[model samples]
Target: MDPDRVPRVRDMRVRVLRATTSSRARGPLLCIGTVALIIAVILGAWVRPAPGTTDTPAAKSHALSVAWPSQGQASALVEGLGDSGDLGNKGPQEPVPIASITKVMTAYVILRDHPLRAGQRGPGITIDRTAADESFSGVESSVPVREGQRLSERQVLELMLIPSGNNIARMLARWDAGSQEAFVRKMNRAARDLGMRHTVYTGASGLEETTVSTSSDQLKLARRVMRDATFRSIVAKPSTTVPGVPGTIRNTNTLLGTAGVIGLKTGSSTPAGGALMWAATAPDGNGNDRLILGVVLHQHADTNPRQGSQAALSNSRALIEAVREWLSTITSGTG
Candidate 1:
């Protein structure tokens, strides 16, 4: 049980060799016999170690001293796209409502069913009456699109992701799978395929309180979805002008461009609180890039969506900066 004692075995071996050498004056035969006996005992105790003993160095645990969100679950990973390792976790592992981060899977499934290349428009989707009505109702974040108005598939994704539009998400869901109920099946299936075991997708837009997931589960989905070039391009945008939508719709993820953040998603609601699935890149201190992925959920729950979102954004920014600083300290050994 005491690893400290393991090193003493080598010291004992050195002493035994010295004893054998000094005893050569007695006789070669006796010295050899005595040395063999001592060596056998040492080898039996040290080389053939007991059940729980090990001579190998213990693996060091890399735990970050992050000031995590005051409430809800938070988990982060480093080098997710490469040789990945978990940095740490905070709060419980149980699943809870994820708000609009559900759209990440919605986008993932749509992309898998209909692939898009760089600069490709993919297909045209007509705005439906429900989506149009939701836009004007002021119930949730949305981009205005008239019913029967046609927009490119790429533009729809831009609106859904950047602005965190619930209606746009449903429109895309219905357009792809004929109904939100069926589309949710695809979302859950995609979650299962991606190894998100703690996740459950009950709706395409994540407006349903039943669409619950853990922070760790969302991080897994974050890594997989970020691989798509088109998906990455859409989430990173700060703002975009979509056809059939008024003005320039902006991304709710304000953490973009801070701490080398590139693209990901943000979700919030009265029940889900503020949740964000975020990605960023920084130097690994070895002249190569490292990808950082993280998720924070359930900040300021039961509050208004705007307040929840603000809390999520603020907490996430602090986490990003702290992670970057941790990396810098590791590389420089100055922490």
Candidate 2:
């Protein structure tokens, strides 16, 4: 309790505090220096090559030809077509109505879940009044099926896809899964499964605004469809008759008989404009086969049916040529 003793005690405390602070500061500096040294060692190790390093050989030689005209505008993958064509504007992602190319998906879903063997009968589907009525009198095309008539599931599928028949699509949607709503759910699910990242299905008939696809997405669908022998056969047939329809339904794909053309689908509506998804096969001089799938959307701005068809044909031809040329370059070791 003496005043002199109190001063002495405070002085000792101040000295102890300063020593503690200095030690703490020095500790941090030591830690920082240690970290810096560790980092420097790591950098030195990374920058040095191994003691036995030899010059790496040049990358395996590749044959050079003109680059495929991707132009960063049109994304193209050429496996066999020769070089020398503009694959066209890849452009910004556009949302175009796919029209009946929707059936390509419909067929894909059915084939994946329920494949049909040659000469095999599919499940029988009764023609509901709604299905028949829609098919017989829908705004778009139809394969005439009277109410109460029944057709094999395979027959309905053929009708739906071959002629892009709306009625058969509705009936098959009803028959296969009990309702078009249910079928569309499956369609969308199939799209997801197939990596159709930008696809959405609003209806079984592409007539509905709900049914939509992009050209890129459609080319994906066409690639899948081409793998199925049954689908390929049906789509390739230029004309076929369903028992109930009064007249034979001709294939709507205009390029069916065109050179190097195989089979695909054509779609058009007032809103969807004109759309076509096509596949072509060209010989690669070697034993290899060249396959090209191309999609054109909104080919015509006007609503005239004839004009729309002409636009579709012209656009499709251009796409086919581009694909063919790309394939040629790839096979020739020029692309």
Candidate 3:
């Protein structure tokens, strides 16, 4: 062969060998990379956190925190009183309107601000024309306060709460603070002081749409109210007749008849629907006292205040029973 041709042949062979080696090396690398990518995808799908989960430490801590009991869980604050199913099969924080239950707060605030002597009359309040016109006239469930009548602060409060009188709420709000707006502000401030963050007061009668509260907040308020001996007595009073009212007014709380039933409030409005706050005290197996504050809000069936209160009373009774049973079982080692 010629020298030039031989050199060219050698160069071509070298190039071919290099290309073969490169192909051989590239094949394994490509295969390995593909395998690695597939493994990564499979692992990612299998091991990843489910949706709505937070991977951060703080979120993880929150996830591990305790949660409220679900609806129908059998647990009682007091043992040996009744079973879990007795009061009502309901969650602790179900939102209900709590109708006249709002009065419990009004009474509490008044009592806190002014300490009245036992049998001492409340501050005298002249009935406003508006209050008188709207006062429980022809209302089956009101303590009648005449248009021109002058009523003691305590008397008006009793009428407001005991009979769930709308007029009394209005009158008291206007009487104590000079205006309903001022009284509402005081009520909201009091609620905030008690750590009822979810509560807002726009009306003394719970008639306004702006006046709102959650079940949890109301329960907290009820707990505080029940702690007061005087407040408890006032709420538990079955019947009280005012001197000026035409007919005797009875307490609207139906739980008064239930065993171990203490005192609480009930409320209802066109906007709020139906709501209730209640506390029950029952003896445990060892005769220890157990107290529970329950609240319910927004039942579909209770359109009227009267019907709503009835439903709440029935539901509360069932819940109390369920809680009692749960507690009894816990003490008996059968829970």
Candidate 4:
């Protein structure tokens, strides 16, 4: 297949189905998404850091310039468990509805306040009637939970991040702080601390139109997420057994095991469209390893359920593949 002719997400929305451990678009922007994606990847290898991350030597000594989608945004940021700056970014920096990608910040706040060791289920919170009743509300995705169920923090995190349980996000928020309002306040403070000036949090879940951000801001959050061992392990899972879910609650991110995509989050809605924040490790031209974090926001998709997530993922895959190609050039001595 031609690198510049990657396919679009036309018929992949089944992957985002709301599940009891169960179910699951081809578009015209194929060429642009492919070509522009490669530019971000190659530039990702050499572009300077933005603010919080360390800088790296530019690989080819050219400025990053790519024509991205007019209706959406995309970026390939420097990836490291260590703090990184920036690599290459395309599209508008304006804050847009990010949907459930808001959960990334939710998870980050939890991890920051209550650090967890790998494999150790942190504090357990008993699921009350209110939590259970709220779990299956409205149109947002959710997992099974009983009113009286007791679950560990890891399990809640898994359900919230994997299946995008909006109720679970609130549960975590309430547990972390005393009330949802207080937790959201914490979220905004964390955003400011991280230099996410354009980012704001109206709720722990991205279901609110008020919960918004840009691709660039999300890339910053993703960089922080990749460094956390617990978050990394959970996001990489295609599926895991949750305490309340009878069937395994699988990951919504279909790209998990492919193309070095380890772990991340996916979100979609009528207003927020589809969005994704992803990370992977690939070698640059120097045969040295580089972590590449990519984000695609406001991607075009069908109105059906997670159709936006489907579209976001399809584009995300193209971007990751482009980054992989960029890395292969280094190992192949062509870089």
Top candidate when judged by lDDT against the true structure: 1
Q: Compute each candidate's TM-score over C-alphas.
A: 0.78, 0.71, 0.67, 0.76
Number of backbone-clashing residue pairs for each candidate, in the order shown: 0, 16, 36, 13
Residue-by-residue lDDT tens digits, candidate 3, 1-335: 33434554555556555555655667977656655565555455455644322221221222222122232111122323344312322243323344566777778777777656666776777777877677646732345566778877677777777778777786777767888889989999999998988677777776555566666576667767666666776777777877778776777777775856776667665545555666777654554567765665654333675565565566667666554443433333321
How would you encode candidate 1's per-residue C-alpha lDDT over 124-201 as one tens digit per residue? 888989998898656677777898998889988998999988999999999999999999998888888889998999
Q: Among all windows of ten consecutive residues in candidate 3, which has the lowest summed lDDT?
A: 59-68
As for lDDT, the candidate ahead, 2 or 4, is 4
Clashing pairs in 1: none
The order of the candidates by TM-score, greatest first, is 1, 4, 2, 3
Candidate order, lDDT descending: 1, 4, 2, 3
The window of 10 residues in a row where model 2 has the poorest summed lDDT is: 55-64
lDDT of 3 at 177: 86
lDDT string for model 4 (1-335, tens) is 23332222211222222121231133436544554555555455344344433222242232322233445777676443222224455666778888889999999999998889988899888876667887667667776699878888888888888888888898889889988899999999999988888898999988788888878788778877788999998888899887557887878899988888887998888877888888877776666787778888988733644677777888788777766675555433233
lDDT, each prediction: 0.82, 0.66, 0.61, 0.74
Q: lDDT tens string, model 2, 1-335?
A: 33435555565556555555655667877656655565555455454534322211111112322222221111222333433222323534455666777888888888787888777767777878886667656368887778888777677777887778887776667766888899999999989988888789987878775576666677667767788888887888888877777787888887887857777888777666677777778654454677766676665533754566567766667656745554544445543
Predicted structure 2: lDDT: 0.66
